[model samples]
Target chain A: MNWVWLHKWGSPKWFYALSGRYLPWLTITSVVLLTVGIVWGLFFAPPDYQQGNSFRIIYIHVPAAILAQSIYVMLAVAGAVGLIWKIKLADIALRQAAPIGVWMTVIALMTGSIWGKPTWGAYWVWDARLTSMLILLFLYLGVIALGQAITNRDNSARACAVLSLVGVVNIPIIKYSVEWWNTLHQSASFSFTQKPAMPTQMWFPLLLTVIGFYCYFGAMLFMRMRLEVLQRENGSQWSTTEIDRLIGEHK
Target chain B: MLFRQPSELVNPLAFFTLVGSLFPLALGTQPDFLRASAPGLLWVSALLAVLLSLEGLFRSDFDDGSLEQWIVSPNSLAILSLAKVSANWICTGLSLVVLAPVLALMLGLPGYCLPALMLSLLLGTPILSLIGAIGAALTVGLRRGGVLLALLILPLYVPVLILGCGAVEASLQGLPITAHILWLACLTVLAITLTPFAIGASLSISVTE
Candidate 1:
């Protein structure tokens, strides 16, 4: 099968139309999956058998942690594509992803700290995983700050992309931190491909939450991409009509 | 790749490394428990070793328009960058590898653990050079960015330091250090495969402005 459509992906107009078609479905899917995850995690799934009620935070914490990392990779890939192809939409994609990544990192840290309180007996420690996550947050913030600092659009995108790619080094550090150090945090007990250490009642909801978070990330990215397209394309005659039509429909 | 080869005899990294390693050696420490911290001392010294060598990687080229010339050259930048980092690994990283036994011995590293220390440094130093390339590439053109460069890279260096030290510590305890070696190898392979593209990309971006 000729997968030529993937190469045509650099076009903003095409991506905008495609994402518009997919956004509503993603929104619905995210809401449904998230609702199921929280309900199942909180009520149906057995508590940690060890940590009791506080164990429920895993539903939020795990998903946020996963999203925080996955989003950065996506951002870097988008940034790479922008750099390679000089695609304006790829730059837009990169820009849209930064705030989402930073926020996801924030949520991961917050929920992880909250989970730590009951499980680890403290809100924070200089644990490898926790500290690296903090550093990842700063890396995201650095990209956003650098992006904003550069007034030139192309320079800003390139700079942010470079920063994100360099920051990709932290992913490994985060992954192996526990193994490398005597940290309070335990090693990863679950793997997506392997049978989770937890029962299906717990694991299934986590899977759902992960899927939901992915959808939510997509929806947020699409919304931001659309806004960016409108702003960037405002000066063009074709975009003027398209944006006006969009605005008129909203009115 | 061919274009990045400099005809000049200048090599600033050599002098930098020679002077840097002596800084800690000069500090007079009492015959106390602090001196007993062999793993910690070696790591601190190694960290300084990596940092000192990193200064001239990108800065010197950046100063003379050679960086911009390399960025726009017909050669594949990734390959060129890989060559440069390989040179760095050879020069400074090998220096660390060869210096490890001597330094470890001075830091009171047990004779039995020297093999593990050397093995860890052998596997770990290239990864440091590779990761350090990204930081050097990022701040290559910036003025007085050494501090920012350290801040950006040191946190990411945590895993390497942890694993590098852990391997030696485990060997000192007579525990199985195989897993640590495997992980360090994995990190090295990952860095070797990925960092060239990253450094090349970052170098171009940094020089563009």
Candidate 2:
């Protein structure tokens, strides 16, 4: 029932220091978890019966794809918070997440394509999931583009928030439409979700990687949010004091 | 005042025809290829034309200080923005619909598919303008918002493009097009009902700044 933390979250100084404390733990956890998961999936997990060892690419591809969607949802939620509560930190978080989301989308698409060539016999196919992922990438880039294009900082944040909110609404429609279009075309590419029942060996490492990736996202988001807070709040009392502390430490 | 103008409609319709004509030159001169590609080609061209016209949707108003007035006016900005978008639909979107037959002819699109093609545009073009106005409003204040406008709006336009072209293609195959047309209508309704609020928000930001 305590809502003080919601308003507490609006304070840049509180968020900055809190996330600074969180950063190291998040970094170490993500790094360790990622290394263990990747190594386990690569070496310990059994090879797929159909895909051979090539199926291992799913370790990276699936995690990136998962992060890709999660980041967009995060954007929409952050944008809504910023829009409704006028939380400056929420706007900063929303903006910082765009490029990270785009990179996740790109990684997902690249790994998907690389995996596709060996398994699906083509470099690209307008399959539903991959096509929707591509659209998600465009949605990310659109937010980034809108942010950079506008001159006024506050205006840009609000504008990007609006666009991303609209994008979030359309994301499902685009996904479903792409899915329907793929079926109508009867695209030659096979659907990846027809996934066979894995004997736990495959999906267990996947579960680890997914967790690791989420931790990585948390780490990256806060780091970016911290830097954004510093840059945007440069002349303010807290940022200036923080700057002085940094400079003093450099000596 | 814009309603009185003829040239406003001329350029986009010209661009629509030009884009439609260029496909045959690039793809092949064969009527068969042109006909087959017509549905997709026309839909894409209309989408582009709507995008091109969107650059000016709020630009002139923003530059002239009228957008700011709309934001501060007693009337609902969303309703006013919807009026502007409807005007935009008539100028850019409907122009493409009227020119659909001529562009289809250039693409060697069959007469039998014309009703489906034009009807699809009738249902789809307003969605283009309505949705595109969001991008136009978002980017209106920027020096080079045109390309960014395309980047932001085109992804949203994908469903419209697919549904509109699919309707025509379905008709070409002697399949029922009710589903595609229904989807297009749904999108147009969604766009009409919702995009004005977004455009209002975006315009308020741009004009206030």
Candidate 3:
């Protein structure tokens, strides 16, 4: 049992230390990758034979879309772990993930709409993929709302976790929506399971951006989680010293 | 103070469930757009039913002091919240599933699509319950929470509505309904697995506040 406690998954103190160390690397890597990917994608990749310059939006759109789903799953996993183990850190992670996930969803929607105007000849369609993505945005909003609505930190964390877990359904809907129904949105051009839909140059920078965005996500999540941990643990002995030190440093 | 007598609500749900199913029938042969919009209309009304039923989910327990007992019970607050949400769904969402075919007919949904419609509703309504529970749990003790609940819940309802309507529409168009059902069923499974945990957490939080 002591050994198991050594590996305790829910320990806030351990997570705080670990995330503090990890934040710098995530920030640096995300910045480098995003810069390289964006530049290479915008300038180097060949324009689409069909959509011309407008196809460039895929660089932003795909990564954001993928991140949106990934973060939701992360939120669900954190929520589940929090519930099952009564882990305080997991709840913090769950809350930290929501706003980032929501931002990713918003970016995806905006880029999709921007991409849509040129490619699909309209800004909006009742298309399954578009609609499902919109719903994905809503799910994120619900989780965020639930988080804010709750007053108690721990209870809010738990509620938010549940919202994340339940809302996981929207992830698959967003993923397969383009395929399940005949719609205005095109099928995925990039996949590991099947041949890449676009040429190498296009997929390469996009992949880089995806990796960069992930690092960025990690950095942001850790930063937020750190702040949440500090807020929630304020009156605790460890945080009291930390908070005093932070305050002194700020002065 | 706000609640009707316990006896009052005992059969109100059943009575309202019947009235709920009768609403579309009363609107017969009127607006062409509404008739054409059958799938959306029934879906909206069904959503409204879920919303209406949600008001009583935590309210009654809250009003009667049972909620305080549940909070302090040996059972975890999360578990109690899950039980309440599932019970609420059984009373409300299950009723929608049972009433779907009749309502489908009234909404002028095609005869052939009735089976598919009912099946989708069976799978989908639970999700509505689960998702709606998040909103209900959040606003459980808030005053005049209907609009807030609507704002919080309506957006979440879109995917279920889309897939539900999609399945029936597919059946009407004679396309393969399997894929649509598969998607909605997938959604249901996801909701079943995830929502209770969420609503439970939300319920606890609301109570604490």
Candidate 4:
């Protein structure tokens, strides 16, 4: 019955301090997992019988793609929270998360294209998944562009929130329609879902990378949110004291 | 109001026709090639024409201060926003639908695909106007919102574009297009019911800022 913990998230000072404590641990976990996962997948896991060494790209491709989509959903949810509850931190989260989402989408698209050259025999094709991911990239760009175009911080956050909410509603419809259109064209040379299951060795590292990517995202988001909080709360007692202490410690 | 300002209707129709005609010239005048590409070409042109018309959807009102008046009025902003978008669809989308068959024929589309082309546009264009109105509302307060509006709105137009062109393409190949039509209808209905609230909310943000 205790909602007090939830309310604490509304306070930027509390979130910044709490996230500061957790950031080092999150960074350490993500760095370890990513290093282990990449090394294991690259060196130990068996190559695809069909794709050969090119299959290793899946370690990067799949996690980035997953994070890209997850970030969009998170952005939308955070936007909704800001809209409904007027939480400034949620607004910051929504704004700060977009550039990271854009990078994830770019990584996914680039790696997918690189992987495609060896596997699908072309760097690009109008495949359903590829097209939808491309659209997702545009959706993120739209959020970032909207945020930048409006000068007022509060207004920009609200506008971006509405845009992201509408986009989240449309993402499924866009994906389904793209898939249906692909079926009509009948040009799907390789389907990700139809691939046979991977061996335990291949997939275990993938699982690690996926979790690492999520932790990495959390650490990055918290870091960005803290910076934004400090900037927005500049000259406030807590931020001033924190900055003075950091300066004092440096001496 | 649209009739009084005939260019509002004429401009998008002209844009649609001009873009449709450019394809055959650029792609060569081969009838078969034109026919094959006509559905996508016409659909994309129509989409762009609707987008072009959307830039002005709230600009004049916002500048004239009527948009702020609508916010302060007793009537619901959602209904008023819906009415504005509907008027926009009538001026832009409806005109494109009615004008599409002429362009389709010119592009060498067979007689059989004509009905499906018109029907798909009839169902699809309203969704374009409704959704684009949200973008228009969001940017109505900006000085140079034209390019940003297109960037924001075009990605969202993908599904409607796919379904619209898919329906016509199916009919071109003598396949059953009922599924595409039904999906287009579903999108239209969903847009009709949902986008008004988004438009209303976005307009308030734009205006209040």
Share of true Cα-Cα contacts across chains kept by each model: 0.40, 0.93, 0.38, 0.86
Isolated chain B TM-score per model: 0.83, 0.97, 0.82, 0.98
Cα lDDT tens digits for candidate 2, B44-140: 8888888887888888788888987897799988899999988878777777888899888777877889999989999998988888888888888
Ten-residue stretch with the least lDDT total in model 4 chain B: B1-10
Candidate 1 Cα outliers beyond 4 Å, as residue runs: A1-9, A39-48, A83-86, A125-152, A155-174, A177-208, A242-251, B1-36, B71-119, B174-194
The C-alpha stretches of model 3 lying farther than 4 A from their native spots are A1-11, A173-182, A192-195, A235-251, B1-34, B68-127, B143-148, B151-160, B163-209
A138-173 in candidate 3: lDDT tens per residue?
778777776776666777777677666656755565
lDDT score for residue A76 of model 3? 91
RMSD of each: 5.4, 2.7, 5.1, 2.5
lDDT for A215 in candidate 2 is: 94
lDDT of 4 by residue, A1-251 (tens): 99998888789899988899999999999999999999999999998897789989889988998899999999999999999998999999999999999999999999989988877788989988889999999999999999999999999999999999999999999999889777322343223356536677898898889889999999999999998999999999999998888889999
lDDT (10s digit) by residue, model 3, range B1-209 = 22345443334345544654565566666645444566666666677777777766788777777877876889876677767767667666776777767766765676888888788878888888878887788778776767767767776776678788887777877888897788788888877777776676666667776
DockQ (C-alpha based) per candidate is: 0.31, 0.90, 0.36, 0.90
lDDT of 4: 0.92
What is the Cα-based lDDT of residue A30 in candidate 3?
A: 98
Best by lDDT: 4
Model 1 CAPRI rating? acceptable
Positional deviation of residue A92's Cα in model 3 after best superposition, in angstroms:
1.7
True-vs-predicted CA distance for residue A244, candidate 4, Å: 1.8
- Best by the TM-score measure: 4
Note the clash tally of each candidate: 0, 0, 3, 0
TM-scores of all predicted structures: 0.75, 0.95, 0.78, 0.97
